[model samples]
Target: MVRWWRRPWIVPFAAIVVIFLAFSIPPYLSFDPARSRVPQPPSLGVAHFWLLVPHVLFGSVALGTAVLQIWPRFRRRHPAAHRRIGRVYVFGGVLPAGLCALTIGAYTPYGPSTRASDVVLALLWLGVTAAGWRAARHCRFGEHRRWMIRSFALTASIITNRIWAAVFVIALSPQLDTTFHGDEGLLSWVASSAAAWLGWTLPLLAAQWWLERDHLRTRRVHSRPSASPTPEPALPHP
Candidate 1:
């Protein structure tokens, strides 16, 4: 009965989410080879670009579905519609996106640090989503909600990933001459790698913290014993 979605920030939060997705998804929608974030050319070719495209597109599906899924009124009023959206989120979104991410992460042109972080993120995303789906399948609504919220946190971390990347690039770029021996490339790589780890990890940790505190508080309240009728004294004298 904990209604985490009934928050005062819902309107502003939705507005921010709309803007975030606008920034996140437009470049990839054109499908122009040049617009791809992954480097192209004789160096890497169009194959990785293709992979990046599907990953972004499918992830967009997941993100869109997550926005709908978290809408408490819609979910409460239309259970069937909510279930259908959840299905698309799992099948059309997470599965394809996660596979592409796993592939791209495995053979990224980036350094070991970025590769490791991305690979682990993909695996955890896939695993956590699957767990949520399983919980729903078993009709464990409470567990399902928690698991799905965790999944959404990971999905939405794509925004944080870009935000952190920009932050690191700005902060570290200035240090190129002093710390990186004027190596702009090294500074960029370091920034990217660090962002890859902190972006998802920090957000996911925050989500877990929020969920854990609620769960702990509820559990403690439930664990307290209820008052009972006084027991009849045994007829020891008889």
Candidate 2:
């Protein structure tokens, strides 16, 4: 059986992430006040837009680099390149985007649930990446790899969040008038917040399950008793 890490789906998964990032990020680049996705705080005014730009741009950088970072073939063939891209993913992509997410999440018009989820997600992303970097610096490569798998899981959760949000909205549409009282705005926040909770949390749980599966397999191998050495037969020449 093929190893899970070497499965054919990994590359295709990364490509889909890149494609989604491309489709989602362009509207922010227009820089028109009318097009801002983030709700600017009354005091912050246009400052939110400034933050959103780098957040999206660096996020794209991080998302793109993370694809390379996670590619087993890339790491095996170009260790130095992998290290360089890791730096970019950390310093450029996740660092800025995670920071901006802290503020943006709090300001989300959706509801408290979404705000809560986003803040928590941002914190975990940064914390996981930091742990991964520390592990690498200390030469604990195994631990580093595990932590980075987690960080990428968090990084990719945004894509999942978008998908969940759309799914919830569509699924709830039938109740727009009967249940939501025909308040489109009300339904929007309800779905958005619900999606926010499921998106990152579910993916992170799956990542943990994946990591534990590998760890358990390793332990199982090590726990097996070694075969006893057999005595050699007396030489016929004797």
Candidate 3:
């Protein structure tokens, strides 16, 4: 039986979703008050708009390439391709996106909860990607894999955040009147803050747990003693 994780379609499906969102995000990329997700008060002017472009662009690059990097068969068959994509994910995606994120996070007009979450995710994403790159350079493939998993989990958060927001709205629709309206109410803010905090964190924790479990299973297999053939020497002596 094919293992669930080993299913050939899994990575493709995930990649499709990630890429679809990456392409779809541009329509909403405007800094105009009508399209912006966050309120753009007068204090946050053209500078905020400029920073957002790289943040979204490189962030999309990170999201789009991460699945290819993690696709097991693809990585095995095209190691050079995997390395190239990894470089794109780091240099082309995470570095510019993360730096932009730090600036945006500091100046976020949203509540403190969101600012904190954004800053934390930005720093973690950069640090984790850098660690993975260093591990690969040092030829520590196992450590590299683990760190990359964590970094990709953060990359995936961009999509997960939107998904959770939709879920929160759908679930709380009856209770929260402003869910459909343009105005942000107390409930909406609470849900947004909670999603911000949980979006990347839950995925990172799951990835870490999966990596740990796989490592333990590998150790068990390595430590297991192979059975040797029973002695047939008695007939030889005779």
Candidate 4:
């Protein structure tokens, strides 16, 4: 299974499909947008709205950047373009995502447990974004790569959320009558939301760790050299 997914096309194709579904499907869902009635203050001022607009616009760009980073041909041919797009992705993708993390805490439909989980996830998302930005600024290519992997994993949570929601609805539908009966609607909503949060983020983090293990090991080896034994002094007696 691991070997199969390692094929260059598999990840990019999956990422493309996931990004498409993430932007397209949420509007149609009954629970989205409308559930949060009491609006929080916008983090960015009105003038910054244009900057925030790219968050929605360039989600596909973020996914495409991930593909370019992995694909050798694209990386070599347009290194400058890749760097420019990466800047766009970090600023455009991560900055707004961090803001949404702050606002989303108030809007969580589930109880405190889920809201708290979201808070942690949001912090993790922002932390990884900052780390990635710092790595790039320092010209640490390996660090930059690993940090971006983690960042993109968090970003892909949007995709995972929907996939989990669909699965939850299918799995829990039959049980609705027996356990929840009339209250099944509420139960399903809570379950789906919770599943969406964990299902997407956790596996992605795990995958990032796995993929970057060798790079991380190489870094550690290069960082510390073995102490060389002192050369023996020439024997004066000879």
Q: Pick the candidate with the highest lDDT.
A: 2
Cα lDDT tens digits for candidate 1, 121-203: 99999999999999999999999998888898899888888889999988887788899999876887798898899989998
In model 1, what lDDT does residue 72 have? 84
TM-score of each: 0.87, 0.91, 0.85, 0.67
* lDDT score at residue 236, model 3, on the 0-100 scale: 50
Q: Model 2 over residues 152-214: C-alpha lDDT tens digits?
A: 988888789889988999999999989999999889889998889889888899999999999
For model 2, name the residue pairs that clash. none
List lDDT for all candidates, in order: 0.86, 0.87, 0.81, 0.63
Q: Order the numbered candidates by lDDT, best leading.
A: 2, 1, 3, 4
TM-score sort, best first: 2, 1, 3, 4
| Off by more than 4 A, model 4 | 1-6, 10-15, 18-61, 216-238
Please report the candidate that would top TM-score against the real structure: 2
lDDT at 34 for candidate 3? 58
Off by over 4 Å in 1: 1-6, 41-43, 225-238
Clashing pairs in 1: none
Candidate 3 per-residue lDDT over residues 1-238, each given as its tens digit: 3454778766666867666675656655654535655555357776776777678778888877887787787788899999989999999999999999998887776667878998999999999999999999999998999999899889888777877877886777676655545555666666777788888899999899998899999999999999988977656555
Model 1, residue 106: distance off in Å is 1.9
Report how far off residue 126 is in candidate 1 (Å).
0.5
